[model samples]
Target: MYRFSYSEILEDAPQLARERERMAFDRALHLLRTVEARGERGAERTAAIAFVQDLWNVLLSDLLDPENALPEALRSDLVSIGAWTMGEVGEALRAPERSLAALIEVNTSIRDGLQ
Candidate 1:
């Protein structure tokens, strides 16, 4: 078995955290775009709704978990994004064309805020 150095882990932590956040954001954006393209009036739309809901649930849980190792500010930001994403997802489920723009706007706003 290979031994991992403490210094290596510490050095990689920020990059790892950034990558995880990027992956989550990308996944959410992909799901949103898929739903938008499919329209919001059938089984596909419902599935997309479920997908976004599930993703946000996982993000929120991670942020709120006591054992989560993220900094407090980062955790708070994740929780905020999860809440905003859930709202956008709900709007998209209700009205795809109208809500898609709003969802995209919210996503962009959140990304800007993160930066």
Candidate 2:
């Protein structure tokens, strides 16, 4: 059996949350990159796109929540970044010539920032 102290339980809660977030972003980035390498593989592209969309939607919702602990200005900026990410994803999907590099770059940046 294992035991924990109250102080330990209370500390670094957000670090755990951030680690989860970082992993999700990494997974999403991997999916997107795979789709990019596969070119026109329909199912992979669809899955990757849906994953990115869902991830961003969840993030946006959390940012918008009144109980969210992030600073007001920082949350606002993150919301804007999320909006741009969604926009770029939509645009890339709509245009055959458009590339997913922007999506990859932005996701990488966000994931790195979580450190």
Candidate 3:
């Protein structure tokens, strides 16, 4: 018979939580970029806008909430980057090439700002 150690399970919780948050953030970012690249307009645009708005709302709230388990610096960075990415996604949906170029520029600026 195989035995499961409770200590090992407890030790893995924090790392697992971190990984889960990271994955969620990444998925949200990917969806934003996909919506931008799709050049969605009309109802699609509305849906995409709503999606990003919801994502940012949740992310910012989580970052600011005292009960959140993430590190403060990481929380702040995630909020900042999520906001910047949302803007870029909006621009891309509106203006494609120009927006894509602007996204690159904005991403670079944000990275520099974080430093």
All candidates: TM-score: 0.60, 0.84, 0.47
Which segments of model 1 are wrong by more than 4 Å? 1-27, 104-115
Q: What ranking of all candidate models by TM-score puts the best one first?
A: 2, 1, 3
Clashing pairs in 3: none
lDDT of 2 by residue, 9-32 (tens): 325576777787899999999999
| Candidate 1 per-residue lDDT over residues 23-111, each given as its tens digit | 66666667667767766567766675676688668668757877667789988977887788788777766764565656656665654
| Shift in Å, residue 88, candidate 3 | 4.0
lDDT of each: 0.66, 0.83, 0.56
Error of 2 at 39 (Å): 1.4
- Please state every model's RMSD to the true fold in angstroms: 5.4, 5.4, 8.1
Question: Whole-model lDDT for model 3 versus the true structure?
Answer: 0.56
Cα RMSD for predicted model 1: 5.4
Q: lDDT value for candidate 2? A: 0.83
The runs of at least 3 residues in candidate 2 whose Cα sits more than 4 Å from the true structure, single-residue gaps closed, are: 1-12
Model 1, global lDDT: 0.66
Superposition error at 101 for model 1 (Å): 3.3
The prediction achieving the highest lDDT against the true structure is 2
